[model samples]
Target: MVTPCPSLGPPAPYVRRNVTHPASLSAWARLLGRYARCIRGRRRDENRKRGSGMEIHWSHVEEISEDERHAIEARLSALAAGHTDMIDLRIVGRGTGHHRHGGKEIRVACQVRGREIVAVRSADDLGLALDQAIDAFEREVRKLREIRSTHRDERPQNPPYLGIVDRVLHAAGYGFIVTDGGEKVYFHRNAVHGGLEFERLTEGDRVALNIEAGEKGLQATTVVPAPPGVPAP
Candidate 1:
């Protein structure tokens, strides 16, 4: 059996803090610091008053250092003429534009929290965008590096070329070679280096572009069989 004693004077107000680790304590300190300094008018509402999403407009990608500015311009051009419409651009650290540099009529997208521009992967690709609002150029280079590494690993020393048949619709006995992507390729009557023969070409043989793109989606410049064990070039 237990006896009921007098109640403690007003239950001590609940203290909600539950610090467990030093890192937690440090984090709490930093949060408290932010709360303390971010009082009153400007600091209090600065982050909250953004219109929708933040957008950084970088019009003067040029006018910077010759190399850096050119790099940014290259990225813009690639985006403008790339196949992928997506560019993971980020606005890591922004710099105030110069007198004749920025603050002009610029186009902006949703600005990212942190990132920068670098270089282009394949200048031959089509359908990217310019007027990029990028920050750093080096980071983009890292992306390029990763792509190259993957390409080197997956791609063969020599891949087959792709092209469209550029000859009469000869159903009987005629010859045609596919023009590789963006370039021109030669398809001799005996050029079908594959197990098949050139004479067996169909109208639209879907293939991978193993060549460079020339004026107006020109066919392959160097047409060849896709499989290995063909005669040397």
Candidate 2:
């Protein structure tokens, strides 16, 4: 005769006690939904703060108050306005040996188009030092923008023309070129192009160039070696 095991005889039915009503369940769901929305909103605000691309660092000093930090951030954002080339900015604050007397130093570094511009200032008060540093930083940024604008305005707009190096100031980093049409155009070391070394350039070297009217006078925006067998004009 075969015997049956006690564990396999029969399964017991499961019962849940104190079951929640449908209305209570709905209320809990709404509460949870509101909590989730609140969390998402906070995350968005934090993300916006990070997206500003500004950072502050403290060295041998305690962190500043939230009000001060906010003020600094606002100032930086205002300074960066309309400047799309700026990548990021960093501010560093340090306490001097006379920390008890409130001596502080502030440094601001700005990165723009792969270039770093920095400014440093020290004062009896941290706020004054920061203000001075920011003022210097703004001036540097404005100067850089002006220089870029000048370079853009100096870009050539016409085709290359044949010319001869009429004069070169080896110590001055500049020279003059006489074009085929007998027009003399000035060229700086920065204008040398086509892999040509400005240091190796000498008087009477045949070159091809594009000229434009500059703030001073006619200038060669680009300069390269002249092609072979090109008849001099």
Candidate 3:
């Protein structure tokens, strides 16, 4: 029989212990939850800052407070909400010669489609100047929209044409007139000229109107009853 190998030392006793401390486990979980919440909060803040597409530039101006900046952004966003064609908006603030004497100037520029619209204002305070500039910009945008809706650029300035009322839709507040050339034109009650009531119109009634290529088709504008004694063409 082979001799057994001698043991190097006495056998060590085995011990069992808890893999993790209960307090530490709970603390670790709480720490992870706090970290997750912090991350979400930061993301929300970032989204709020990026919500608007307008850009602001400051020149020779003092740093503004967060409240003031937020207020300005809210106003700009409100102004741009209804206009889908507005591609870009920029607001520039400048401090003139001196804070007390020269005051501040604000300029708001909007790029719509291929055109640019701008408004500028100067006031003793930056807030006042910005408000005035935004107001002016809003008016410009309204004017531009009205012009486009009427297609004023494409309308002809020729003399009015004579036509006869072909049909009237009393309930709908609109009517159609047949021109002397046999072209049919649409007219809304609002188009009646000289404050004439649309209800007064009847089939076969003579009317003079300026025509334009409207969104739907040929439409009459500034419609009025033909002058007495004018022979129908």
Best by TM-score: 2
Ranking by TM-score: 2, 3, 1
TM-score of each: 0.23, 0.41, 0.39
In terms of TM-score, how similar is model 1 to the real structure?
A: 0.23
Instruction: For each candidate in the order shown, give its overall lDDT on alpha carbons.
Output: 0.38, 0.72, 0.71
Model 2's lDDT to the true fold?
A: 0.72
lDDT of 3 by residue, 1-233 (tens): 99999888987888888699899999999999899567545543443355432334444434445466566656666655544345346778887766664478887886543357889888888778877888898888888878887896686553369889999998776799999999999876656765566888899998888777754588775688776788888
lDDT of 2 by residue, 86-179 (tens): 4446778887767655578888876554457899888887778878888898888889888989897576553469989999997766799999
Model 3: CA > 4 A from native: 1-63, 98-101, 152-233
Among all windows of ten consecutive residues in candidate 2, which has the lowest summed lDDT? 52-61
Candidate 1's error at 107, in angstroms? 7.9
Per-residue lDDT value at 91 in model 3: 75
Off by over 4 Å in 2: 1-63, 98-102, 156-233
- By lDDT, is 1 or 2 better? 2
